[model samples]
Target: MPNVKSAEKRMRTNEVRAERNRQFRSRLRTALKKVRAATTAADATPAFREAASLLDRAARKRIIHPNKAARAKSRLTVKIAALG
Candidate 1:
């Protein structure tokens, strides 16, 4: 219901960004799950690295809070260590 041309364009931009963010968030969740799902420390190592990278990226882009990313990474490390 945007009557103004600029508002209409903004709405389109918002929609595009929302979809892109959703995809990125989904990937982040999948990466975290991959790390958590690994039962062995060896298997978890690689997944942890990938998940850590995604977490940092998400934090950098403000998709997630930096502290939240750090906390998740810490928890994953603990989980992997417990698997050891």
Candidate 2:
């Protein structure tokens, strides 16, 4: 549907970026799920750390808001602590 050359290029770039952003978002979600599923203290610690890192990366890349990242990290930390 792109009629102009620049428009076509932009469309292609958009598609690529969209895929990359989707992958990053999915990865973050998976990490969060892992943290949520953690039943043991040892299991939860690394999962929480990984989720925090993923949240930070997503926020830095503008996939999610900074405050949202902080909130997620806080909740995950609380869950891990409550495991004890």
Best candidate according to lDDT: 1
| Residue pairs that clash (backbone atoms under 3 angstroms), model 2 | none
Show where candidate 1 strays beyond 4 Å. none
Where model 2 places Cα greater than 4 Å from the true spot, the runs are: none
Name the top TM-score candidate: 1
lDDT of 2 by residue, 1-84 (tens): 989999999999999999999999999999999999988879999888888999999999998999999999999888888996
Residue-wise lDDT of candidate 1 within 1-84, one digit each (tens)?
A: 989999999999999999999999999999999998898999999999999999999999999999999999999989998999
Worst 10 residues of 2 by lDDT: 75-84
In angstroms, give how far residue 75 of model 1 lies from its true place: 0.3
User: Per-model C-alpha lDDT, please?
Assistant: 0.96, 0.92
* Native RMSD of candidate 2 (Å): 0.9
